[model samples]
Target: MTLRLLPLLMLAAATSPADAVPADDAPQPAFFEALRAADLRLATIAYRLTTANAALCDQLQPQIGMPIHALTQYAPAARKAAATTFRFGATIGVEAVVAGAPADRAGVRANDSIVEIDGKAQPALPGTDAPENAGARDAAEAAIANAPVAQPLRMTLLRDGQRVPVAIKPVAGCRSRFEILLGSGLDASADGSVVQIGEKFFEGYSDAEIAVIVSHELSHNILRHRARLDAVKINRGMLAEFGRNGRLIRETEDQADLLGIYLLANAGYDPMSAPKFWREKGGDIDGGLFRSRTHGSSKARAEALVAAARDIAATPTRPIIPAVLATRNVPLR
Candidate 1:
């Protein structure tokens, strides 16, 4: 998840007014402006990369026919509570599983709750631990890697409120990677390699809310917004100038929000929750004029996402255009 820093207003209030420095000296404004520009550049690059990668995936989708290793964890009790109140609570745990590969065709759903792995009860890990923790998703991936090749592996899960058992065979010639970064704020590359979530803003969010955040970021990658931005930047020589075209930035942001809503819906998440999540997070209602360079006002983002969600909800089964993939690699991990 991307982490967004506390707004300057919030930060200023937290510290002594006497200690407050000018915007130019304080790293927030200028730094974020540069960061935002970098995000724009990266987005364009990612779009091109994803477009190429999608073609590869499509080709390999038939030949390798392997399930993409993916996992999600949800606590039923928590979900029920959230549904009742329309708010998500803390996550209980996540179940790591596979999707889109041969494993899934064997009846694996990413939603399956994992109780044990490799004949042992799964140990609980700290929810606050970084994604790289051994017992987190990485550990699950390793266990999957060590299983016997071509032989279905045993898995016990709670599906449909029943204790169901299943077997999954591993696939070769596939690799998985994720982008990670520090600091907080919600933003995605136009191309979609990285999604930033504001750490301070996540205070009251539930796992589902976080899912919306992740989905928004992932949407940028899927839609190739980043690559489009990069192409524009190259044509205008913005990289050399260390500047950006304001209109282009707004267009990309709007595009990301719209596409993000669709991605969230397709991924089976509540698209409406996205706007709700932002509203609860205090997103700018006035288009974030106070912090225009980094993000638009929480209110503006919420309103825009809500509209996009409405459009997406109305067309639930429509196929999305597969974005072209670029070859540029992501640097942050």
Candidate 2:
């Protein structure tokens, strides 16, 4: 029951069903399938963690887990394909309902345009100067994510050329938007507001593996590691994660690893899977956290995680938040 098997299985079904979805009328670009699939995987797992561990988060967001997009974000060749497939317009629209999320439970579906939320007109993209405009995507997301969590949201959706109204009771969740970047590299990062991983991660990894990495990234935000690091004034350049400067960064990584497994467990993912993911995939990653010198070796990292996970497994009560989270705002040494 802790694994929240129903939501995991929903995402495991992965992508749209073959029988229900119609073929693209216009030829889609070669990358469309891969891109959509990757985004869906990232979004689903992030939703699972954020919603499940809402009580542990300091910042809260309304629990609408589906991602949105504007047509402008797509390259010219791919715009038609994405818009037709995802039901986006010049303005922002729901990319997919992300089955098992609050939106899907409220009867929202892929391609539905968010006409209004709580009686205010949804934010609109002002222009399309760049065919591939990632900024537009970010802006659109900010618009949608602004929906408040204090009450049920009265949302109007554009479906089948009709304006359909639905009331979605908002579930308070950890405030962070999860996204996937378009690349083949093994990059994963978190700003205070967003968590991003390369498309490559979703392609080769299973749900459990993806859950481990994403929980780690989300841990950075939950702990306010970025703000704390900024206060400590550590170098972030190519050779930064070395010597004295890297020690603080290493501490943050270790904290993330410790807290991350708890998040994975709280979300009903097996805690031990964290060690397995890092032990198997850490060396294969060529950049980001693994590139740091003071950060433990993959073997060391896995061992540390295994120890922590075992402790949690041994506890009579499961899924307790790490006490270190209490010191999140204390200045890093």
Candidate 3:
């Protein structure tokens, strides 16, 4: 078999899991740059996935159209870091712009400093007394995301030290928005309409691998796995604090893996990458509750992914759900 699943999975399974770092915990200013970079890449991949399957997203969530393609500057310590190599002062610049997304189409480019939105000057940073530019940047993001459907937002940007005006036209997409949490855990998860990825994921995984990870987490939201588990009255708390309901937990993991293959394929990514990522990257991720608890063994999960991809590839129509497993439900290990 071309699948190299066992090696990485075994390595990851054996490593100790790290506790999740709270976002409020402040790190050094130098770390913000990496967090910002990770946010850009993760957002780009997520935009591709969500927009590629807009129809499926609509089916998944009726309110499928709030957040468009745009990323804010990660400038938590912008004021404090001005004395460093970065001389931009407290100005927050654009970190990512999805190709052909509203912001990109509106003439916004990476590194452009957002100055004003809808003719209103931005507010001060959350922790600084310096003029409201930092707060304004955040306000600009909310402005774009919450803009009325079919309405265009007028924004003023400081690009190359010149004031440039742009118009961003918002479009509908899956209701979920993408976010990156700066921490040292290799994990990603979705809650309601939001898909959040850990910053460490970017340092550890390739773009294709990241896509597979995001697709799997996104699958959970699309399939409403969390809601379904709640509906079924699964005692997630007991399993976390007390003991094990390992089988049932593994069932959900299995279902997400199977569905994620279709999502990867539908988004024009290599379905085979799913298995490859597992083989090479799985071992670095099993931590905290992810430590040898509920998930299926690395080999079993990778084999199932390979099998599912093969079945999907043998079909003619682009299926939202694979045929061989359409009537089946894959449970967690």
Candidate 4:
């Protein structure tokens, strides 16, 4: 994903588990519960990694790296099932995609089969020793920390009906590692630098749903909410600072939501997914207590985002600005 250029801001908010839930009508996946548990454990691991690797983290300043948590979606074992219908596999769950980094810009589409890694078939590895199945979550982290930067790695996958091979090279300076924490709530910062989701929300969501959360937080950074807030503070003067802060914060939050919809759609994610996710999760009641205190009430957020998306869809694209053409020195018209 392309980085959005925006200033950073320090905005703080508390979190609690309140509003996250799936619709009563939808069939709940057992694997999602396991994934949620894993996500919480991973968050603890990340907190430790941040502390233990402070120097390395500083060396990698302004660039964030986090493990790609593995998620499972049922795909057909045969070509026929690939054509039209599919079913969720038994024991659907998620694990950390050891050494998988989102900053690498490698697109791992939903439902893609992971057949081999580094020329070794996945099943060939020892059951307890494989990176994906290891008891320790840090196995993947250890692998990545030791690997040489910018080296190309091979990933063999099955896409659609054909087998394919792809090479991925990690990039430097990409910040923003994430993990889903337990509890229901939504929280975001001004610089769009971090996002934390409640474990309940994570369990009820698909990867696409999580992507919406990520993209929305990213939009906050892209739109420079922090800088805008600073400007607002300056113009308001010290006397009104406390009084105006609340309203200003609310406006920026709304704007980030609007911009987030566009960002997600541009990145090829489902634009409508956010609204649907919130709606099923209990649209903004009592400031989404079942969700997060930082997020707006569920009904308000869902309604506002849906309206914003409609406007975005109806709006026409703007033409790109061009660079100046080089000119010969001697010619005068």
Pick the TM-score winner. Answer: 2
Supply the global lDDT for candidate 3: 0.57
Q: Which stretches of candidate 2 lie over 4 Å from their true place?
A: 1-30, 123-140, 286-289
lDDT of all predictions: 0.42, 0.70, 0.57, 0.40
lDDT of 2 by residue, 241-330 (tens): 667678988888889889999898888898999889877888877355477474777888899999988888887554487786897888
Candidate 2's displacement at residue 192, Å, is 1.5
How many clashes (backbone N, Cα, C below 3 Å) per candidate?
Answer: 51, 2, 10, 17
Q: Residues 246-278, candidate 3, lDDT per residue (tens digit)?
A: 556566677778878888887788889998877
Best-to-worst ranking by lDDT? 2, 3, 1, 4
Using TM-score as the yardstick, the better of models 1 and 2 is 2
Q: Which regions in candidate 3 have their CA more than 4 angstroms from the true location?
A: 1-32, 59-78, 82-93, 115-121, 124-127, 130-141, 148-153, 160-162, 238-247, 287-293, 316-333
**Candidate 2 overall Cα lDDT vs. reference?**
0.70
Model 1, residue 328: distance off in Å is 16
Clash count in backbone of candidate 2: 2
Write model 4 residue lDDT over 1-333, tens digit each, in one string. Answer: 111100001001112223222322222233333443445343333332332223222223222123322211111121122112212111111122323344234654433444544454432212222222222223333333434445755556555645567565644332334544333344333344444554444444566666555555554554455555565453333342244555555555665566556655544455687787667754433344332333477677889879766765675552111110011111211
Worst 10-residue lDDT window, candidate 2: 1-10
Which model scores highest in lDDT? 2
**Better candidate number, 1 or 4, judged by TM-score:** 4
What TM-score, computed on C-alpha atoms, does each candidate reach?
Answer: 0.42, 0.85, 0.70, 0.43
- Candidate 1 TM-score, C-alpha based: 0.42
Q: What order do candidates take by TM-score, descending? A: 2, 3, 4, 1
